[model samples]
Target: MSGSLELGHHSSLHQAQDSSKCLDEDGRTKRTGTVWTASAHIITAVIGSGVLSLAWAIAQLGWVAGPIVMLLFAVITYYTSTLLADCYRYGDPITGRRNYDYMATVQSYLAGGIKFKFCGFIQYANLFGVAIGYTIASSISMMAIQKANCYHKQGHNSPCHISGNFYTITYGVMQIFLSQIPDFDEIWWLSIVAAIMSFTYSGIGLGLGIAAVVGKCLQLHTCIANPFLVFTDHFASETENKGLKGSLTGISIGHVTQSQKIWQTLQALGNIAFAYSFAMILIEIQDTIKAPPPSEAEVMKKASLLSTLVTTVFYMFCGCMGYGAFGDDAPGNLLTGFGFYEPYWLLDIANAAIVVHLVGAYQVFCQPLFSFIEKCSAKACPASPFITSEIAIPLGSNRCYKLNLFRLVWRSVFVVTTTVISMLLPFFNDVVGLLGAIAFWPLTVYFPVEMYIEQNRIPTWSIKWLCLQTLSVTCCVVSLSAAVGSIAGIINDLKAYEPFKSSY
Candidate 1:
């Protein structure tokens, strides 16, 4: 069982060569993906709607602990991701047959079992949750655009209420067409576009934060949020003494209940965890890299490292600057939270970029799930034309899309379902945290550690083995707490919320 599966490359290679000159060892069309493309995919996945919430997450965590926690997560994710990379090809880190997706990678090294099934369920469920989260996130940004313009026309004090329900439906309609992208390779251009948009908005958020902090550097600010908080023990004296507005510990009892503070801190961990969740898609991205001198694992390690470094830098700038700017009052979404309303055009661009980035990110997370369901359908009904047949739709210049009826109907239904759910329960921060807390340990930690140990033949309870297991167990506890916190948040939100009628 430790040995690699039988090599099936030759027959496919031979057949592929007969029809085309460009072919990989597995007899597929040559993979043109380079380190840049792979990195683009990783960035697009990593720097998603999650980053918008970083400022709020940090608000829950004080300045000292917030960045520290982010660094800890970054280290853990990078190390485990490299392990996942090593497991991408079964039985050999370099030359063995590929595991095309996360489930395949799990099946290869860990073997098919209950845990394997659990991985599939968790992965797909997380993907679906991400879809809903993105819908909620993008709708908020769209509504923010309208609200921002309204504030320009009206005063800053004007409510400028806008319903997110329409925006959610609009995003779902956009996804219905985009979701038809067959696979990761086909969506390379989209990923690149999304990655660029991520940078655009991230830079804007960071700049706005810096501008806010510097613009008020000399001002002796009042405790504008609350009259009582300024003098209360909960609002630490350091807020006035030091020019920032949070305690060494985060928001305290005067600002919120003790229980709420506890839950918010744990929920903040989930938000940080969510920001580093490209692991589920890492193998699929690695599968795209052309046959390598450095090896896909090595290339992925580099990409992982680079992407992690880049993301950490962006996150720190955005989160820290945002916290510095608004202090304890930092909003859930840095751009859409109305922290900065002037130069509404810039705010408009940043929000537009978020919408665009999420469109591609949605497809990125969903493609593997789409592939899984379609494969199952073909297996179940091999003779059904509805499942297998495709209609040729022309795009001119000798280009055409093979549109599948089942894919169309099924993906459309999936989009609509997520859209409706998002409308019903559009608690954005809570949803993001819950999804992250649910997926982080199992998908991001446990499986990778297990697979790496199995593939490397690491002996039971050896020093390295014990250390790795300890890390996994620790992450499990963290995930549990984050989940509880997020669930509590959602319940609290529902106390006053009306489904499909909530407005911003």
Candidate 2:
């Protein structure tokens, strides 16, 4: 292995100069290629498969509760992101010693190699799981579209017969095909196309849904009912189950006594995972950000703050409007929920858009995993014969192409295998919770705190500051415990079925 990536060792002036020269020669160091603009990045991060479930989550809560929860989640996300950004801003300049990976290096500093490796493995696993989740979500979106089309054609009032296994297979094939295509530059254009498609289809779908719902209400004016208000009363009157109440029994704030309140809180908290997912993306990007001068870092911080506020507003509006239209029992897929009251054309458009958006989002989500794989390959086999011949000897070859082909192949296999497992299990609510709890939450929440404490050389703290730190750690521990329990529940739920016994 090359000893070039020594942890905590500062780069020499000669090495730094060489790196600067290479960056200048390649034109990669310029701000021109960087897509760090606040608005654009925020929008890209915010718009994902999670949006499909946002309204459904809110519907579980009272209508008024959904947007409020989204707003709170956005605020919390922004604050966490800011903390991460601050850490990145103040961090030392060492290659592979920043961002999430930096957490491992930090742990090595504070603890030892064993802890570092363990933390690294967990964080990497979390990211890999997220990639699988995105793949599954995209596939499901496609299946939904297909089912909707089938219903329209047959004039059948029955529920569509498509299953999770079908979607899993379909998504796995699509991802493999997409992954084989070369050229990372093309992803930006693809993302833009997806955004446009999503906006157009969702816009049309929203219009049609509103029109139909309004017309139906006018025709049956006397019987017309507000789903939001109706559901609120129903939920309030309902008794809370021991299991659900037990699940939410302990918390500092927002603990619920009534079923309606509990439902609302659950819905609101469900979306929090999505918000945290987006924040994780931002944290990953921190490594690539050029170390601006102190003044520039301050400017970028301001921009980030503004961008976050804008995102919060957008989420609030979207969540509120969605809950208003669909009320409780909004379809797990937002497009489908709207489609229930919208015209065929609108549903068709929305369906197409969701599929496209999910494709792009999935790609973005997979980047860090790919990067990790690439790094591991570089260290393990710097000049693999197969990769050197097939990839590195090309006319426009870069050293990065020297990455081990075997590693890439293995990574792809791992992704496909896990995705298949996820598919064979359940889809929808359980999968979301399982993915978030088992993978996403630990990576986003627990790892960050550990990394920060490990990496930074903090001055001695006062008694009050020490108490505050302890409190913060306690909160993280509680959140992590809850998240784990939630995931275990989901796993139990999935295990109860034996639809495909012996398939594993």
lDDT for model 2, on a 0 to 1 scale?
A: 0.52
lDDT of 2 by residue, 194-247 (tens): 777656655544443333333333334353375533323322222121011111
Checking candidate 1 for backbone clashes, the offending pairs are none
Give the per-residue lDDT digits (tens) of candidate 1, residues 424-466: 9988889999998999999899999999999999999899999
Backbone clashes, each candidate: 0, 1
Output the number of the TM-score-best candidate.
1
lDDT at 223 for candidate 1? 40
Q: CA lDDT, every prediction?
A: 0.85, 0.52
TM-score of 2: 0.70
Measured by lDDT, the strongest candidate is: 1
Q: What RMSD value applies to candidate 1?
A: 8.4
